[model samples]
Target: MNLRLSGRIRVSVFGVAILIAAACGGDRKTFAPPPEIFSEVDADAGTCADRCSLDGRSVIRCSGEIEPCPIELACGGGSCRQPCDAVATEGSTNGCEFYFQPPLLTTHNDWPYSCYATYLVNTSTVPVDVGIEFEGKALDLSKAIYRTLPGEAKLAPHVGAVMPGDGVILFVSDRESPIDNPRYVACPKGVVPAVLRDYYPDGTQLGSSFHLKTSAPVSAAAVYPFGGAASAIPSATLLLPVASWSKENILVNAWEAWRTYSPGVQIVASEDDTDVTIYPKADVHDGVGVVGTPAGVPATYRLQKGQFLQLVQPQELTGSAIISTKPTSTFAAHTCANVPANVSTCDILGAQIPAFERWGSEYVGVGYRPRTGDEHEPMPYRILAARDGTRLDYDPEVPRGAPLTLNAGEVAAFGAGVGEPFVVRSQDAEHPIYLAAYMTGSNGDYWGSGRSWQTKGDPEFVNVVPAEQYLTNASFYADPTYAETSLVIIRAKTDGEFKDVSLECLGGPVTAFRPIGTRGAYEYARVDLSVGSEPGVTSDGKTCYYGAHHLRSDGLFAATIWGWGRWTSYAYASGMSLRSLVSTPLLPK
Candidate 1:
């Protein structure tokens, strides 16, 4: 025990910034310690006295004689200075255990929550499984991120038990479906304001950081009721050479095998620039192409097989073949609308296209959909306009900002969201955003023509169009309720300038709503529409769209667990097989 403290208590712990207390003549007068001079001692009170309530609860425990405490009478030594109360443990109240509160969520009062964490500043690493969703919900469930080795501290199978400030719902990927996880990143609700901040694995800002924010303007909505479910403790921020499409630079590549094989991928020119200039070879291949450039120079095509590709680089990227051997784009709308019309069995269905323009209008026009359902009930239908004649509908009373038309044979399915209604037209009354399209059969199921069987299992066809004899105009209205529906748009900066922007959608079934006019998601760090303009529009106006099918089936009615069949019944009832769950049984490739 090295307990030495005498030369007048070593001048009172170095004069403690002068709280002297009456010494006149020599000039010295400071003293602050009379708030009832209290002191109590006892000990231990963990799990926070079972969630704190114990009425006037007490427990201090310091021991022996050290008294003196003029420094505000030792904060009175109660729970050692309030380790968030209930009763503290040691140091910073045993390093604070958990109580957050702002906006994260997964299950809440029901449990099974998720927003995990295990190392904010190096708890050794592994335990990173994040998912925290926010903009319009429907992330479902996701897991897999625990990868560390360097120093090796471990213990974060996605952490858990957090409360500090609240606000979360992460869930980025559980094997496809928060609209097929295009690098997912909604994060909105409360924008991270609970407290206890200290990040760095690429999200930046560390030590004493926490949630904070008070200038307001965070809500994208959803803290509780709307669908209900809460969980938070999860957090994420990693992009790197971007998990690989080689690493982003085609400026855009809706999908031509990563802009003909990563001619260096990246996008977002301004609003804080990621550098934007892409054009090594695929200026516009599947969406419309120019191709040949071994020196040749037509350099100006139009691509359109369902739409995909948006590169942005200074051009000039020849190819000996790290990728573009060509031979891929049969593009029957992303593979004959993903077969399934009874094509034997396994089942498939794909089609995408969402490009809308008019905020300042600069020639934007693109709309397509076909993510049906059937191979054992896959479920998404989004089609919107399959045409058969001259019909069009969109009015919903017609007052709130006008402009609506398109009803012919109907074909509008925006992922079936029950009751339906919203044809289109917004400026935010509170939260409008609507646009529909539907069609999927090959047994994928969505049923149209001769309905009934509970309206053919109703995956939410919006009313299946047909409202007993067309003509209801007033602005047209039908959608009543189905809950989760998305296809929002508005990311202007030039052609109309909305202001520092970034508003995207694809949590599911709302594909291709463009406006990349650029405005920060980290400047478009690793964009991949497939390369520049999925439906094409951005010269400086921004807008790219694509949302197709995501049914995510898992029986027993399971709602989460990656949505479509609880990860294919957790790899077929646990026998596991996506090729032996990613395979490695001795490594063969």
Candidate 2:
């Protein structure tokens, strides 16, 4: 094998500007090596010299000294790599041969931020020494391996001297330079095995665990949720509350009731004398049956004493939780009503409960059971949302602030795709909140690729993510409710997929709503600054160590995440590495 492979690899400029003055080719100064650093040259003419290895009589040189080499090398400058030619078949016997041009990173004058992709033979003989540290925080270091290749980089050979293993690593300095500061830094030390961890403020750690060497080239199609410019999300109103009931309570109540009335249950009320028909249990063949309100009954039918209607639910329904609820109207859409039995909160109810199902214009109550006979019963409660008549839509390619829904699975909402919107009827009002998505991947662990089909099949299931994978303690605003809420659905064919990614307000003056079950989908995750009290609190709070799941299409697996919380600051740090995660660009250029 001619270890010296010939090829050109394209480098990615992740929206960061290094030198403001020069484009790609223009240059000025003759680069000089830093003081005390000397280039080791090949002393023996037509022979191996100074740490150079040899295969037979051929001197294998991935990186060594060459007096006649042309280009000037500048170390510690964070500048683009200037290529040099290989005069001989220089093969390195070292574990994984590596050599930087001239300036290796040092503390003195290095740029605060620099991005470099490590290849098997260019800069490291052993695993790369990746480190992350804040000005006052402790320094962390670790060994890294590559997962995917960007541009034209090849895979590293399992047992060879010149493997093509390469992937990008971003370095950031805690220095307060307006131009050169890299926002995030990763350490070499591996903790929580398999997950990538970013640290800040001395002891703060961000994100879950990431496996070693799984970082790869992100495709142009990968979508990132934090794609918008940092902006303020003015105050907004609440659309609906996602509430959860104890699984045991819901199932216990349902099961107990089912056992008591084996086939039929009686309906009696302290106020109403007329008996409402009830279905005792769920049918093995057609599911559960719901009783209808007899003639002359008021539209708002309260649950009678010991008169419960049969509802077919999830097998895991240890109890039932209200995933979401929208506002309801009496006749002319003005008689707004609050949630049934929950509480009589909120001042004005425009349209709190949104149409739960968006079946291509066909709508239904918030809690309509899909495969049951009682599916026709009007939903028990309605969400008390404002009717600013403001609606927004979601588009995978559109920028944030564009209307969207909070109805996607954990991966789509929290990862790349934009999602359904949470509409606000009121023009502008503060609605402090936190959103989170929880999912179970094929591997109980998010970074393990060899574990199951779910991990290998989908591009969306990225293991190593930049910080903020688990969004907590953040503020947000509802996209306008007047426009049509654009819902961009990103369904993956991979196993261990995600269904609903929910958000809850843990801090703030107003009461918060909790999510019960999976009901909506988000194409991409979003945060708002104007609606919450801690305008400064954002997704930058924590960093996750694992890669996001990849997208796939051949099995029965789904991952869903549950989120909730509120804190001025988090224990995690930001600006870690996304080398292990996947990417989807909103624009082509």
- What's the CA RMSD of model 1 in angstroms? 31.8
Scored by lDDT, model 2 comes in at: 0.18
Q: Write the per-residue lDDT of candidate 1 for residues 237-290, one digit (tens) a residue.
A: 111110011111111111112121221111111111111112222232221121
Error of 1 at 259 (Å): 23
Q: After superposition, how far is residue 150 of candidate 2 from its true place, in Å?
A: 2.0
Give each model a TM-score.
Answer: 0.19, 0.17
lDDT of 2 by residue, 219-278 (tens): 111010010011100011111111100100101111111111111111112111212221
490: Cα error in model 2, Å = 11
Shift of residue 396 alpha carbon in model 1, Å: 50
